[model samples]
Target: MAKKARVRDYDQFIVRLPPGMRDRIKDKAERAGMSMNEAIVWCLEREFPAPVTLEDRLEELATMVSMLTDSKDTYSGVVHLIAEIEETLDAIGTKGGIPADTKFSDMVRERLDYWREIELDSWRDRNESPFDDANWTSVEEPPEGDPFPNLPDDEMKKD
Candidate 1:
């Protein structure tokens, strides 16, 4: 006959349980598919798990903040782009969905085609003079005399 080597190598210790506690532990052990000892150890481990350091929490928070910041930055541009797309669709006389009517689809396609044609040309033909300081009129200070010199302070204060 082969010798049955003990699987558990640790020294055994006696633990006193209250009345009905043993039965409860047995039930839990059966439910968990573990022995009473294994179930007790599992429960204790779960109840008192490893302690988390402040550094670990700070790192987790930093990762979360970084992810949120990245998402915010990306979504900001997406919001503006979506708005522009909606506006474009509205201009073409259709909501941002597939049109049931073939005529409406054709109209949308035509509008898109026209826009595409003019888009680059418009960019190329942009009036650079508007951006030039030479073309801009400098703001002059208001005249020393009030334009409404005839108007009294009381009249100006009237609702």
Candidate 2:
């Protein structure tokens, strides 16, 4: 067994409360099986776990909104491309799960070629003058303080 450390006395700060609040605190303390001091400490810690600052939260929210907005425009295009690829692959029916023929292989290759051509066209368009300028935004200033809040107890132990 480990030896217990000697208890040290700390300065106590006085606080003012309404007349009946003390009684309520005593009752709550009894209900929670804690002393008034322990209850107060518990309340303070639970309400104010800190690591990330409010500025961080605000910036995080802004970043999320921006990503969500961009994803709205991009997701459908991705889904359509995936569906087209799936349909083309489905058309190339399997012999023991491997594509059976040179003809089917050629068709799949053609579909892939078409997909690559579309991607190249998109890259070219984005790289051109006006679109290229619009593609990136001015960088924002760095946050002043810690941005992430403390993880809840359960999350602290997870992989």
Candidate 3:
């Protein structure tokens, strides 16, 4: 039986290449395990990418907007954290000052505790609105331990 011929939907074109270009195409085709025509098409596609359509541009813009919204949420969280630290330092000074030998870890732990338990209460004591409707605790809880600890996953003790 006669083998069926290959049918292509693409238009055929005849072109002349510069010296050694034909050999380069042949080498690329051999390395990639494709025909010389395929190699040429691949090279052309690589050098000239498809144009972005209106829908593509809108999708890209939408992605950027989403990223910005995430950034804003993160920024607000950080700002609230700094404010909590300031309040804690003020409370410490008024109540009994920290000992000179207090470790940085202790301060971090205290800040975290203050954020968790005492934060809302402290606001109430100071006659500040809890902003109960838009509480940070509801949005993003503070980390319990070092977020980027030096210890590896296996070395670190899990709770």
Candidate 4:
């Protein structure tokens, strides 16, 4: 038997785009090969993302700190930065964002996991490592001291 079609209970809005904006949206929709509505929604989602839960924030901070600790100046800073791009590329190719013939799990992944939480799929996707409590720092008490309090004023002696 064929599967039942998924119901789309989307709210409708009639937007008035100025001058070339409509054409731009249409072009983007065409390039991404998605419906104008889908393209618009993708843009909106990227622009106004959901609030980061406290757990998520802590996880991000932990990941950054762990990676930083392991590296002389961030273990794989380039990859980390690329992975931390401010925008999501969901509408890069097709309706699914990824190629129609490809599955997300099958895509090439170069992982560098510093910590892990098995229960969360997002955490698992980032790569998994056994958690260590010692790698954490409390936000309430940050490290003290300024290495350069008076620049261009304090002279250093060659010892």
lDDT of 1 at 39: 92
Clashing pairs for model 3 are none
Those runs of model 2 whose alpha carbons end farther than 4 Å from true positions after fitting are 1-11, 50-159
- Minimal lDDT window, size 10, model 1: 91-100
Model 3 scores a TM of: 0.32
Model 2 Cα lDDT, one tens digit per residue, 1-159: 557665465446698988999899989999999999888878877987545433454465456555656675666656555554454455444433323455755776687779879988997877666524265464553334623234465875683
lDDT preference between candidates 3 and 4, better one: 3
Quick one: RMSD of model 2? Answer: 30.5
lDDT ranking from best to worst? Answer: 2, 1, 3, 4
**Off by more than 4 A, model 3:** 1-7, 60-159
Listed in order, each prediction's TM-score against the native is 0.30, 0.27, 0.32, 0.32
lDDT of 4 by residue, 77-104 (tens): 6346435521122222444332322243
Identify the superior model by TM-score, candidate 2 or candidate 4.
4
Per-residue lDDT tens digits for candidate 1, residues 31-108, read 989999999888787997655433453465456545656685755554454354444344442443322455654675
lDDT of the structure predicted as candidate 4: 0.53
**Candidate 2 — which pairs collide?**
52-147, 52-148
Task: Give model 4's TM-score versus the native structure.
Answer: 0.32
Error of 3 at 49 (Å): 2.4
